[model samples]
Target: MTAPAIRTGRAGPEGGSRRLILDMAARLLRSGGYHQTSLREIAEAVGIRKASLYHHFASKEELVEAVVNDGVRFVDEAVAAALAAAAQAGPRQRLEAAIAAHLAALHGHGDYTSAAIKVFTFGSGPVPESVRLSRRLYEDVWRGLLAELREAGGIAPGRSPEALRLFLLGALNGSIDWYRPERFDIAALSREFAALVAPNGVDAAK
Candidate 1:
């Protein structure tokens, strides 16, 4: 896929400069893991100096946090929207919609997803509590959905909602390691994953 268009200048009509830096940083993080990404490189990508870049972000760690936080927020919002949209739909429909929305966000927000996953699964050292909390919030959103499905008798009663929630999340998030949107559309892949976790092959049609 073509690289996302890069914008420049100091916060344009819609606060563009700050967004440009974040976008550049996110792209860099996606192409090269967090360890290899640097503020200087982000600045250079935005056609600015490293010193000027610090004007927006206090340090590399801060920038990393910002990128991660933004990603988490984006995901949280997507989940909320999906759940709201699928409120009237059946459990399987809700779950599929939620998963598809998440995958789309991950695909479009590649940089944030890459950084968030890297920091979450294999961080170098102690991450800021805020980062951990943000990750938890994202997980909780999924767990909440699973709980709703359980209440609706969508999943088998014998299985723990928490366990099933983890299973679903593990399967969905694991896609980042291997998923190529060009090869598999979000809807088709999410449906396949949802079916894998459905109890007793419930609603295979979904």
Candidate 2:
């Protein structure tokens, strides 16, 4: 059988096709996890021949790599957009907006976003270094934000910034298992998190 038509250079339609391939790859990988999804599965989902994927990705790993990369960029843009929209807000508000955007970016909005939530095998077997770097860069963005909050006195006095960062990030990451749009609004969750980590506000009430 003739392989499905694919544009190699992504001049126009080929570029669209390339995006389709990436989107399909992200979905399949997000649903089945990286190891479970194969090039054949992705191609089948795209209604293309398995070999046709070669026109886009060199191998399954490459496609998965791209998915993770897309996920990183997706979250990065979200946080940046949140910060941009709140340029005039105080550090506390900016931090809250960033937290909300972070959760929104991870709320299974799409395969790329979902992939960021579920894919965590970086710096280990099968995961690439580039993926790890991208993930780290995202983490650094959070770190920088938290640093700003600490410097601005939004974080409680004498609180270990490093420890607080770990707790907040871990709490946010854990939402992947339990967070649901129907049950809890992303905005509320963000507000709650921001308050919880904000010095003596949420914790003091507790």
Candidate 3:
């Protein structure tokens, strides 16, 4: 059976109070590590009583899972858009465009990216297998793009596409920790990153 569909956009009340709780939980998870974040804090952040928080999420672990699931959904959408664009363009152009799209999503959706990084890098205890699988699917999106680029000769011939993919992914994903829009724009940075890894090794136009 297919996995349950991950929720996106503004989850309405049909998603119920649980949706509100998850939103607040996601924010807290972004600002603080899982251990540092508390249900009480999430409730307060939502302007609800601590007891009411349980009505939505049973425990901290459950809340964390929701946060991860939500984040994965956000990333999936971004990657999907990039892939769609890549399909219509040459490898080099597509890679550059895809990187720009990814960077735009990351910089524009700071809270989502922050929560995703926290869950992926340092979650408390063992995460549920479902959550792990969701994260894997998220990573696979980039891997697929990199593979397509390599097969199309967009990437250099001698380099390991897998290694280059990992490096690019690491740099792109790690931007969540230090990226500041005020200091540098997303498009410029995306171009710079793409140029650094381009097969010709030439700097991308500013």
TM values, all candidates: 0.85, 0.85, 0.82
Q: Return the clash pairs for model 3, or none.
A: 13-16
lDDT of candidates 1 onward, in order:
0.77, 0.78, 0.73
Residues 1-206, candidate 1, lDDT per residue (tens digit)? 58455544545534468777888887887667678887779999999899987888888888878888887788778878998987777777888888888887787645677667655555677778888898888888888778867766677768887888877777677777888868888889888877766644443343
103-203 per-residue lDDT for model 2 (tens digits): 88888566697775566533235567898798788888888888877777778787887898889888887887788789999888888888877744322
Name model 2 segments beyond 4 Å from true.
1-14, 121-126, 200-206
Order by lDDT, highest first: 2, 1, 3
Alpha-carbon runs more than 4 Å astray in model 3: 1-16, 122-124, 201-206
- Report the error of model 1 at residue 30, Å: 2.0
Model 2, C-alpha of 18: deviation from truth (Å):
1.2
Give the Å error, residue 144, model 3: 1.6
- Clash counts per candidate, in order, are 3, 0, 1
**Worst lDDT 10-window in candidate 3:** 197-206
